[model samples]
Target: MKKERSFHVYAIITIICWSLAFVLSRLVMQELSSEALGFLRYLIASLVLICLIPLLKLRKVESKDLGLIVLTGATGFFLYMIAFNKGVKEVNAATSSVIVATVPMITALLSRFVYKEKITTKQWIATGVSFLGVMIITIVNKGFTISNGLNWLFLAAILLAAYNLLQKKLVQKYSAIQSTMMSIFAGTIMLAIFLPRTINEVQGISMQIIILVLIMGIFSSAIAYVSWTKAFEVAENVASVSNYMYVTPLLTTVLGLVIAKEFPEVSTIVGGIIILAGLILFNSDQLFSKKVRIKRIGNAELATAAQVIRESFATVANDFDLTLDNCPTNGAFTQAKHLKIDLDKGQQLFGVYLGKKMIGFFELVYHDGYQATLEKVAVVPSERGNQYGEFILDKARKIAAEDRIEQIDIGIIKENRRLKKWYQKNGYEIVCSKQFDHLPFEVLYLQLDLKDEVTNE
Candidate 1:
């Protein structure tokens, strides 16, 4: 109980620090344009990250995965920063902060739509009620008026949503540190386009502003993100922890009144209160929880190995030219042969389960002398996009490292471009291709080198 309480206290501290960031942002914006500030902040943050990441610890991602990493960086960090910075310029700090706080909700919505995640009616109700809060705030503030200045705020909110979703997606593939570093690096590239103007104007800048910029980049952005990620790892519910974001507007408002000496209007306070209440109700799951089982299979547990393999290859069976038939009463048993092992030893399989039934299964196979292979990967039609696949892959990768596998490979059909691309996005390389096993189909082989740090793969 003491440990739990202490951890929560630490989380609360993190929340408070994050909230203060809003006020600091507003102050920094008073002196610098949002774009210029973001450019400088991320530039400095990237430099600090590079220096701190340790020279001997660099892990190289496959060349094929570079595009996806860059894309993740652009969407998650670069675009998010651009949107948040630009939006804050148009709206009050409190209002902008409230909108930005809806990032998780937006990600849930996008995941439901784009990834075909099965969002429940309860989730829909919460989303609707929360959206109502946004509407109430907007109406109470004023009728919707088309001002070009205010457009940036809404755009920023949308971009923040995209960034949040992208971050969640990419984090499954890479560690938080790797994902963050890549994002900062990519955002820095975008900021570099402004180098000429910034360098020319930087000569006239005061040391105080430079120090403030450094503090924002190094402390608030870099260190804060690392801390936030750590808190998220142990939190019971992410939305509950995120609900603490309701305090951000209050913190910024207080800072505005006390430090900036600007009195907030009635609408700002009223809107902020409404948003806070809505967030409370929307994210109240931590207060009263209902448990649901999600079935998972791992390679270490051999009891369910056959079942996992069957489910993982269900679709592949139909898609391939070979017609797999029911075997003898002996059931699914491994037949070891050179290049035709029924199942590799020490391989792990995982899948999503609901209640007592298995809903999906994905496979991870380890070769004695070669890199690990992630094969027979599939999710049941009903469970395809609920983030279960990503979870399985991540667990498989972690287990592969524990087993000392030097590389990871995934074999996909040449025609299944979407799956192939998804593998590439998750840091796999197509090292070889060939037609084998009498399937008449061209097989695309992928590899993820684990030669760097054992943890990097």
Candidate 2:
């Protein structure tokens, strides 16, 4: 616990340095072009990292991982620096920080497609909220128009998100320092195109700007990455460390006022609030929410349950191209009337509630004294990734066990390998598969023995 707390401090230190960079970069850019500023800043960072290599005893990059390292350098430093420097010059430090704060959400969104990570429905809403914040900041000044600076900043956010994904892969095989050092080295090499201009700019640079650039390079670029990586290593998960980024905008705004004497515009404050709201909501499951409860939903609540099922299953239907005409019996097409019929026929319906809101639903059918079936197990599309499905399924298993059922059977679309794996992880085994002529896809049947003591209680 002490180690985790220390890592949290490291993460905060990194964020503080990053917040300072937003303000200091603006100051340095006053006298330097974006290209020169990026080149000079990273050049100093690369030299600092090189000097630490021997002290840190960093390992050499493997030949196979060289491509990935270079890509990280290109995206994280080379491209991101250019865009960020230009954007910072055009926008206030507060606005720049708020725009860049969307990196975590963007990274999460990318991970959904790249690594098959699950995002809850709340997170989807949060992503939309953050983007809406960005849109407001972009158009607040010039009604319905976006500035070139905002465009560059948005691109920078995307490039950084790509860098995060690449870096995450590299860190698995290499130390954080080694991964960061190599990427910085590669990025500095790419920025070498501005070497002549950087040298020319340095000759006439003011001492104040020089000191600011040095601070940004040594503290923000080199030390910040090192500390950020260390925090990730010691923290329980990536989200724990990454959540610290939510405060970047607020910290940058305060730093800008104190250090750079640049107060944020009204739009920046408003937009930053919205962006932070979304970020808070995105992480609310970890921060604000209480434990979920599984309850036996009654007939009076069948209509709401039906809506939850339809919304949840609609995503599956859309994914597999199953329409009402082609797959009318699908849960996406379910109505309250159907649920009533099921209830009258002795089927049990349950809802997974987070406080008063129902986020998931499932039905259980007892086939006999020793057998049962699980059906329509659905979690609201936006409410996924919280393990609500697992919660509901566990409850179903317990209910079956209490009723002395020997086994529980379930069916899923054969093409949904992710779902299949999820069930398998929960002690379900494939017993058989069937191709129904009426349905467009093959169905795989899985069964779970209630006697297995490993069932999640």
Candidate 3:
């Protein structure tokens, strides 16, 4: 109980620190340049990491991974800071906060493209809604101008998204403290290029700026960055922890009201609500299904698996069949043969479950030591729209990785252009199209190479 409570407390603290940093930076920027403020903020945070080096008892990382760590820092921390520092100057606090609020959706898109994370139609709708909300707010606030400041903020969002996905990779390999420290170290180095510009004004700056920098450096940057990294390391869904950032506009608005006596307009409030609404809709489990990448199947589950296969392939069978007599998925012996081929050939047959019931099943029949064919794919008739087909394809990819299989092949008939396109989108490329003796149409043979795939999941 206490441990979970502590996690929530720390997570909330991290969000509060980050969200309020916008307001704090604005106040301090009256006397300090953005470059100096960002550099100093992270410099103090980097020092905190330096202090924790011995305490964390961190392990040494690989050379190749270290290069990625450097890139992560450069893009995530350094570039994000520089862009946001320059960008925040032009926009109002609420506008800046709201514009930056689109990070989660952008991150999701990056994950889809860079990491091949499968998103459903419903999830796309959510992204659209959320994006609409952002546009509405931006237009209302300042007539949607893509000026230097807004552009910089957009660039900051892109850099931070890049940083986050790369950091996700790092956390899988290194401790949160270790990766966070290295990233900050790299970022601090990048900030050094601008030292000359900010250094000259330092002597003339007032104590108010110095005090705010100290507050931002210690509490906001140092503590907040570390804690935020830790949350990513420990949370089941990094998305869930990150979703807390949506609260930033609200937090910033309240802080602005209190600290600067600035109140938001009606349109800003309405747009902000819509933005939150889009985010909420997008994460509504419509797009990124928990049903994918989690379930596993064995022979014991064959009966349920068979039923799914039966319901799933019924349309195709009906289109081709004069009778169901020879259809493998139609009956006791044929359906069980699908199970037996896996048993007999040292192949794999698995079902993806949604909750306790099986929604889909796939068969991977080994061709040789290096290759396997996707023998069958079926999603239960009742469960088609949740990207269950994509889920099974993803599961097949993971099985290939674990079994040390080199390539997974799928033979789609030339007539099924839609399925062919779907396969292309899901990381499968058409190796060749060839005529098959048994089938009347040419088979479009597609293969997904598992050699370079990063994750079994």
- Among these predictions, the greatest lDDT belongs to 2
Best by TM-score: 1
Error of 1 at 362 (Å): 5.4
Worst 10 residues of 2 by lDDT: 448-457
Choose 1 or 2, whichever is better by lDDT.
Answer: 2
Model 2: clashing residue pairs?
121-382, 121-383
- Model 1, 142-216: lDDT tens digits are 777534434666666666677666666565456766776887798789777767776766677777778777877
Off by over 4 Å in 2: 289-457
How many steric overlaps are in each model, in order?
A: 8, 2, 1
lDDT, residue 33, candidate 1: 70
Once superposed on the true structure, which residue ranges of model 1 sit more than 4 Å away at CA?
A: 1-17, 60-83, 107-131, 146-150, 162-176, 189-212, 228-365, 375-382, 411-425, 431-445, 452-457
| TM match of model 1 to true structure | 0.68
TM-score per candidate: 0.68, 0.64, 0.64
Per-residue lDDT of 332 in model 1: 25
Pitting candidate 1 against candidate 3, the one with the higher lDDT is: 3
Rank by lDDT (best first): 2, 3, 1
Q: What is the C-alpha RMSD of each candidate to the true structure, in Å?
A: 6.2, 11.9, 8.0
lDDT of 1 at 386: 49
- Off by more than 4 A, model 3: 232-240, 286-457
